[model samples]
Target: MGVSLRDVADLAGVSVKTVSNVVNGYAHVAPATRAKVEEALSRLDYRPNLSARNLRRGRTGVIALALPELDAPYFAELSRFVIDAAAEQRWLVVIEQTDGSLERERQILDGVRDHRVDGLILSPIAIGADELAARTDETALVLLGERIHDGPADHVAIDNVRAARDVTEHLIGLGRTRVAALGAQDSAVSGTAPLRLAGYREALAAHGLPETVVRVERYRRADGAAAMAGLLTGGDRPDAVFCFNDLLALGALRAILSRGLRVPEDIALAGLDDIEDGRYSTPTLTTVAPDKAELARIAVDLLRRRIDGRSGHAPQEVRAGYRLMARESTLGR
Candidate 1:
């Protein structure tokens, strides 16, 4: 017969309830008891039956992690971080991609009432206030990225406005004007897009420049290349471009190279979210770096607390400050 909780408890010389408490991380068990239980579990190779445990405790020990797209490097990295953090706490993560759709995000939220997961960690794209408010009551949901309604759920996110502004300022400091901001999805009602644009404008305004030179495009490399092409073909071309993301920046780089324009000499490019590829690309990207791993740690921590019915430990609006990484793309130094 396979080893069970009872076998583990017997080997550990502790009551089965004590072993259970240790397994569940109930926080009431003594250190010595926990050590004994852990040792016993290791010796017996005991793995708790998660389904049976869920049935007994009314908790799935699982969280729903929803993002816009897994294809994006930012979202993929974020998911990896979140999954790792959840694993540390003995919880499992179920990932879902909503594709930045309002209806799909609503559907995921509605699934909470059906007990699909013990809690939810959502990065919503086009959620309405009513929908956000409706979902907050029944489930433990922690909002990420854009600020949703501030009713019941906890929020862990970067200050997108400030981060974006700082990145813009870095480009400005490189002595480049006629700056262009790129990557604003069509039908994007979320504040993240505009907030980033606002930052770009603010940077321009600080330098006594106008903000009329912006090209809104979908959040894709192709969109970025097309937008850049249009700007170059037009009469007024920006000497510098601050893209919303690394992917867009990559596309911009492609467009610049295709047009036989020398980066940092003819035009400089910068972006946010310093992905791995950014570091390795020819004329390495200049961008704003977010503490991605830390963000994931905080998100997982918040979700776990909500599931445990604990409150008031919320880390209030962590900035996760951005670092302006100056690379050859902007100005070789």
Candidate 2:
């Protein structure tokens, strides 16, 4: 027969109830008892029956992490951090890619509530307050971005507006005018798109500069490159451009270079997210770097707390930190 909890308890020299308590994450168990029980479990290679345990405890011991696109470097890196953070709490993560589709996101919410996961960490870009408000799930759902801020869920985010404004201001401080904005596909909506654009405009208005933008259907390298190329070939062009994310900014860089335009001399560039690819680009990108690791940690922590019924009655809002990373992309030195 396969090893079981009883065998682990016997090997650990502890009562079955005591072993169970340790397994259930009961803090009252002494450190020595926990260590002994854990050692026995390791030796016996005992894997708890997750389904039975979940039925008894009403917890699946797993959380669903839903993002728009798994291929985006920013979301990919965020998933890595969330997985690490969740593991520290003895929770497994099941990632679901929504492909920025509202229908898929809604389906994931329903699926999570159907007992597939104990909680959900959602990074919804296409979903809005109306969509979120329509749900009646009691499952612990924590949003990972500012797009759905008004929904009835705990949220973790960076100050998108302030971060965007600071990066735009940084470009302005470098004496670059005729600045154009990129990555605002739906500026009328109450999401990251509008919030980041609001920041960009504030910086421009403060400097007494007019706003010009190259809207795109998506925030990807190909779209960003296309937007910049069109701007360059047109009668109107920007001396500096603020892309909403690193991917878009990197795309614009390629477009800038392909046309034989020297960076920061002919066109300065800035972007958000400060992704790893941005750090190593030919002329290192100047970006508004949000504390992505902290964002993941906080979102996971909040979701865990909600699942444990430890969070306050009201939903929580936590804004992670951000900073402007100025480098070769916008400077001569």
Candidate 3:
């Protein structure tokens, strides 16, 4: 038979109520008493019956993490951090990929009514403010990206405009006058591309430079390569390129090198999201590195607050920090 709370309480010379308090993370227990109870728990290898405890508390002891694309390095890395954060809270995480589909995202939102999980952390790509506002599932939700701003949920994201501006400014400071931006999108449901484009434009206007943009259907390496190829052949070659993400930047690097062009010599390049691939690329990559671990931690913490009824009536919009990592792609190795 498994060791019970009674066994721990008996070994600690305390009542079962005191043992239960410590197990449940109650603050009323004295420090010394808590330590003693913890020692007793360890000695007996007493594992709490999570199922029974959750049943009593009316919770599932689980949370859902919904992201647009699990295959994206940024999202994959962020998911790792979120899993670690949720583990600290003793909560299991179920990850769902929406593939950036509006209908698929809405279906996940509607699934909240099923109560399969206690809360949700979502990095939306398609759903908008109206869709979020119309949600009637009453599930504790925390937004992870710039998809739906100021909606009826806690939001955690980096300052996309500022991050983009900083990367663009890095190229300008390198004396690249003809800087072009890749990854502008026509979608009105997603805010990431637009916010980044705004930042790029802001930097250009501040520097008295012309604004050159390449619209992309998606943020992928192929899109970046194709756009770079077009820029090269279209007779308006930019001396520098700022891709919205590292994958695009890497793709552009390949296209430039395939044509025997030197990076940061003939044309400097920069991007956002410092994924691992950026660091190990041929000339490396100059990119903006958002505090992804911190973003995940904050998102998980906010969701836990909502799940525990500790959040206030008004939703919170928290901005994570980021830094521009100057590497060989722009500065030369």
Best by lDDT: 3
Q: Each candidate's TM vs. the true structure?
A: 0.85, 0.90, 0.86
For candidate 3, write residues 1-333 as lDDT tens digits. 688899999999999999999998998999999999999999999998877777777888899999978898989999999999999998899999998888888999999768689999988888888879888888999999784566878999999999999999989998889999998988847669989999999999998999899988777899899988988997878999999999899989999999999998999999899999999998999999999999999999899889887678798999999988999989842
Off by over 4 Å in 2: 6-44, 147-149
lDDT score of residue 272 within candidate 1:
84
Which 10-residue window of candidate 1 scores lowest in summed lDDT? 313-322
lDDT of 1 by residue, 103-159 (tens): 888888887767768888888788865656655456777877765435346777777
**Residue pairs in clash, model 1:** none
TM-score result, candidate 3:
0.86
For candidate 3, the per-residue lDDT at 176 reads: 86
Stretches of model 1 off by over 4 angstroms after superposition: 1-46, 149-152, 213-217, 313-316
List the lowest-lDDT window of 10 residues for candidate 2. Answer: 185-194
Give candidate 3 misplaced runs (Cα > 4 Å): 1-52
The CA root-mean-square deviation of candidate 1, after full C-alpha superposition on the true structure, stands at: 4.0
